[model samples]
Target: MEKIILASSSPRRKEILNRFNLNPLIVEAKIEEKKSYNESPEQVAMALAFEKALWVCNKFNNEEVVIGADTIVVLGNRILGKPKDEEDAFRILSLLNNKEHSVITGISIIRANTNIKIIDYESTLVRFRHLSEEQIKRYINTKEPMDKAGAYGIQGYGEVLVEKIDGCYSNVVGLPLGRLDYLLNKFFNIKIL
Candidate 1:
């Protein structure tokens, strides 16, 4: 197996890869995640993922395979990012209550030694159950929503907030395993299984 480097600090992302037995080196990419108004949600996600992967790959001899990813929550044209504060978390959760939104994750893989790089994105439709103010407040107190893109983590206590999910569950957690496996196999001749 090739040496894999994960260019993210997210534990959920690392955990997902670990489940596939791809024990990757954790190399957190120290790039500012900027949201672009001109680009579509997909473009923004892919661009951030590419930026992170390229940042880490530049430090290596290019022989290592680096993976970077970004997840975003979108309600119509609005992109709901991580909450700035507890109040912000409340507002975000309130907006998403009883509404269906989209979770899009962008993934980028780079193997500069082989001159191989690929960027792709996955979208999952998530419907939030009708949440009472007390429920949102209680969930906010857990602080899980502060660092997550959607003010809720489907893998944690936030799972109760979800009424239905129409797509990849892993994508909502921060990475898209199926898409990542496909990209690895098709582009870099790598197979997790």
Candidate 2:
């Protein structure tokens, strides 16, 4: 099996890969995450993911596979990232109180010492139930919303706010395992476990 490197520091992504019994070498990518003014959410995500993968691949000379991913929450045209502070989290949650948002995760895989690069994105629609001020405040007090996109994490306390989801559950969390597995098998000829 080719050595696998994960170019991200997200615990959620690491956990997901671990679930498949694969322990990848963790190498974080150092890239400026600035969204282009005219770029769509999907484009930004893919670009970031690609940048991360490319960065890590350049740093290693061994024949290995590098994976990178970026995720964002979008409500219409606006994109929401990790909140900067408690106030920001509260404001973001207020806006998403009773609305549906889309979570897009872009994944990139590259082969070290080669030009082989594969990039794709998965989108999941998440609908939040109407939340009262107290409910939002209580959740925010837990500090779980600060590190998550759109000020919420579907796999944690924020699950209570989700009314329905219209796509892959894992995509909303961070990575899409099914799509990732397929890509790995097709491109790298490697199977999970």
Candidate 3:
């Protein structure tokens, strides 16, 4: 197998790739993730993903295939990012309580030597079960929601908070495995299988 590089420090993303037997070289991209209000959610996600991949791509040989991903939580037009503190986490969780929101992940794959690049996004609908203020506070105390978008991790203790999901489950976990496999096979002639 060719060397694969992951332009992210997200453990969830690394685990997702490892689950498919693709153990990518972990190289965190040193780029600022700035969301633009001028662009749509999908566009912002894809652009950030591409920038991350591109930043990492410049540091490696062209033979290396690099993957970059960014996940964002959207409630209506609002993009909920990682919480700044415990209070912010509470606010985010409160906003998501008993509501269905969109989880969008942007993915970018690039082979710098060939100048080949593919940028795409995946969207999943996640509905949170109704929760009391105490439940939200206890979950916040767990600190799992501090570093995650939407103030929840569907794969963690936060699992109990979700009523259901309408799309790719892995997307909510930070990567979309199906979309990733498709992109790799179609654009890079690489197969996760």
Candidate 4:
């Protein structure tokens, strides 16, 4: 088995890997997301994911495989990140109300001290049911939206707010485990199952 490192601090992402019975070394890659003016959502996500993986790999020069991922909620051309406050959360949910949005997660897997790398993205279409103000407020009171993209978490209470999803459910949760498994098998000869 190849030594694996996860370049993230997200418990959701950690749990996803845990489902595979793999306890990877968790390294927090401290890098601020600086949005480029002209980059698409896919580009932004991919670049950030790669940056995080590179950051961790640079720190430890060994035969370790590092995985980094970044996910964004996009409505039209706008990117909705984690909410700054309750008001912001309400605003995000309001925009998502009765609308179909895209959640794109970028994943990067790289081997330390080597040039082997895989950078890819998975996009999921999430449709939200029409939400009343009270419903939004109630969900906000749960505080589940504070730390999630688009101010909603499909894996938790936020699932009720979603009407349907057209793509990978795990992508909305944080990581696309199916896509991840393929990458692991393809690049590192590692398989989750």
Clashes of each: 0, 0, 0, 0
lDDT of 3 at 66: 96
For residue 33, model 3's alpha carbon misses the true position, in angstroms, by 1.0
Q: In model 2, what lDDT does residue 26 have?
A: 94
- Candidate 3 clashes between residue pairs 3 or more apart in a chain or in different chains: none
Deviating ranges (above 4 Å) for candidate 1: none
Q: Each model's C-alpha lDDT?
A: 0.94, 0.92, 0.95, 0.94
In terms of lDDT, model 4 sits at: 0.94
**Where in model 4 is the C-alpha error above 4 Å?**
none
Could you tell me how far off, in angstroms, the CA of residue 88 lies in candidate 1 after the best superposition? 0.4
How close is every model to the real structure, measured as TM-score?
A: 0.98, 0.97, 0.98, 0.98
Sorting all predicted structures by lDDT, with the top scorer first, yields 3, 4, 1, 2
| C-alpha-based local distance difference test score of model 3 | 0.95
Candidate 2 vs candidate 3: which has greater lDDT? 3
